[model samples]
Target: MRLTVRHTTTYRYAPPRRAVVQSHRLTPSVFEGQQTIWWNISVPGAWTGATFRDGAGDRIETVSMLGPVEEVLVEVTGEVETQDLAGVLRGHRETVPPTAYLRTTRATHPDTGLRELSADALAGADGDPLDRAHRLSRAVAEAIAYVPGETHAHTSAAEALSLGKGVCQDHAHALIGAAIAADMPARYVTGYLFVGDEPMGEASHAWAEIHVPELGWVGFDPANRCCPDARYIRLGSGHDAQLAAPIRGLAQGVGEERLDVSVDVAEAAQSQQQ
Candidate 1:
């Protein structure tokens, strides 16, 4: 399938910051399942610097803006051809050991409740790691109702599990916690999910990727109750959401930072061969 994506994020500072610096993971991953047709990232009045691929095989670019800048807009326009790899991340190069993901962050730190949830999710399930992973994903989807606006960036997996409701990020976090509790290494993935016939999902989507001994890293979206297919585009991964955020930066002398994001992912028409 071919897809086109347009994502724009605007940041406004009330008092107009002196300077702003941002790191982006906005580029799509290079893998067997996906190919970039055309892609670009634009930030007016910003100097691009030090673009490099990280150990996780994600392209990272830096942008610096000198301000008196009240507003900054970052725009991304791209087209990609994607194939369904059954959520198995194949043909991607990365140097980081999968065991590195076993380390938990603040958002995914498992408490007693999360541990118990993991136990219950896996109880009476006699299967290999892959089968058990699916079961755990289903458990998370069932346990947490997909209710947007119920949580925030600081919300933890334990909190979301206790509430029994959250958005995709929360679901990913809770599922990551469950995977860790089961002794399976898991990480958070940030990317776009093309919800067919819709303008877009609420925002750019997030999911969990677990390292299966035989299959390597496999993507699972508990919120959607399935593995990533052609409809999904993988961007980057980290121990948790913040680490894998598409945009992370700092503004000097900011009164307050307000952000607005718009994303649209749609299937593209195939061209006829001559």
Candidate 2:
């Protein structure tokens, strides 16, 4: 499958700022399951800075805008060819150890409820690690309902589980928390999902990746109740949604920031995989 993506993010300030700096993880992952056909990122009037590959093997780039800048825009356009690997991440180079992901962030810290949930989900179920992971994903899906606008960016996994409603971010965090409770190393993934039937929408997508002995990193989307496949385009990843954010930066001056974002992911004309 081939996918084309267009993403634009704009920031407006009530009071113009003197300077702005941003770090981006907007590039697609290079792995056996996916190939980048063409990609570009642009920020008008901004000077491009250092570029390097992070420990997770995601490309990181920086940009700076100096002025009484009131508005800044970041645009990304790309095409990628992807194949279904049953959600198994293969041939992706990374220096970070799997154990590093075991560390919990504010967004994914498991509470008492989450610990119990994990225990109950795996209780008396004798199977390999893969089976256990599937069971945990199913349990999370049953616990949390995918309801947009029910939660915000700072909502933690415990809160989402207690509320029983959240979007994909919450689902991913909750699954990560549960997986860690089960003694598995899990991390958050930020990416795009191609909704083939409908017109493009404003939101991007997220999922969770767990490390198994047999499989290095396997993706699971509890909100959709399935493993990521060709329809999904893999991007950068981190311990939580905030850390894994595609864009992060700060402005020098005090300016009330207003943000607008639009994203479109669609099937390309040529299909590269069956």
Candidate 3:
């Protein structure tokens, strides 16, 4: 399948700042699952700076805006060709060792509840790594209800587990925490998902990738109760949600800031013809 994506993020500050710098991980990843046809990121009034790929194989680009900068806009427009790999990440080049993801982050820290959940899910299960991963994903889905506003960006996996409700971010965090508790390496992934008569959260999506000896890194969306497939667009990943954020920025001078984000992912032929 081929997909077209239009994502725009708008920012407003009550008081203008001296300067603003932002780092982006918005570009699609290069792997057997997806191929980038054309992609562009535009930040009006901001100068484009350095560009490089990190150890995790995610593209990093920087941009700066000179103040008094009261408003800023970051836009991403792209098209990609994707194939169903059954969520197995293949042909992807990355320097980071799989063991490196074993370390826990604040957002994915497993508490007693998570530990118990993981143990219970695998109690009578087989030893196959892939089967273990699937069990954990199912456990998380059954435990947490997908309610959009039940949590926020700073919500931790432990907190989400206790709440028993959250969005895709919470589900991913919970799955990561549980997977790590089971002595597996798991990380958070941010990307886009195309929904058709399904319960997909939004055009933008978050999921967990678990490393198995049989499969390198398999994408799991506990929130949707399935492995990522052709409808998904691969992006960057990190130990947790904050680190894997598509956009992270800082303003030299501060006033209260407001942000709005909108994303649309659709079939390339249909979107392009418009």
TM-score of each: 0.96, 0.96, 0.98
Model 1 C-alpha lDDT per residue in residues 1-274, reported as the tens digit of each score: 9988889999999899999999999999999989999999999999998999999999999999998989999999899899999999999999999989889998999889889989998998886889889988999999899988899999999999999999999999999999999999999999998887553255389999999988999999988889999999889999999999999999999398889999988787632221
> Mind giving the per-residue lDDT tens digits that candidate 2 earns over 70-136?
9999999999999999999999999999999999998999999899889999998886888889889
What is the lDDT of every predicted structure here?
A: 0.91, 0.91, 0.94
Q: Give me the overall lDDT of model 2.
A: 0.91
RMSD list, candidates in order: 2.4, 2.6, 1.1
Best model number under lDDT: 3
**Cand. 3 Cα-lDDT:** 0.94
Q: What are the runs in model 3 whose C-alpha is more than 4 Å off?
A: 197-200
In candidate 2, stretches whose alpha carbon ends up further than 4 angstroms from where it belongs are: 198-203, 270-274
Candidate 2 residue-wise lDDT at 256: 90
Candidate closer to the true structure by lDDT (higher is better), 1 or 3: 3
lDDT of 3 at 250: 93
Q: Following a full C-alpha superposition, what root-mean-square deviation does model 1 have from the true structure?
A: 2.4
Give RMSD (Å) of candidate 2 vs. truth. 2.6
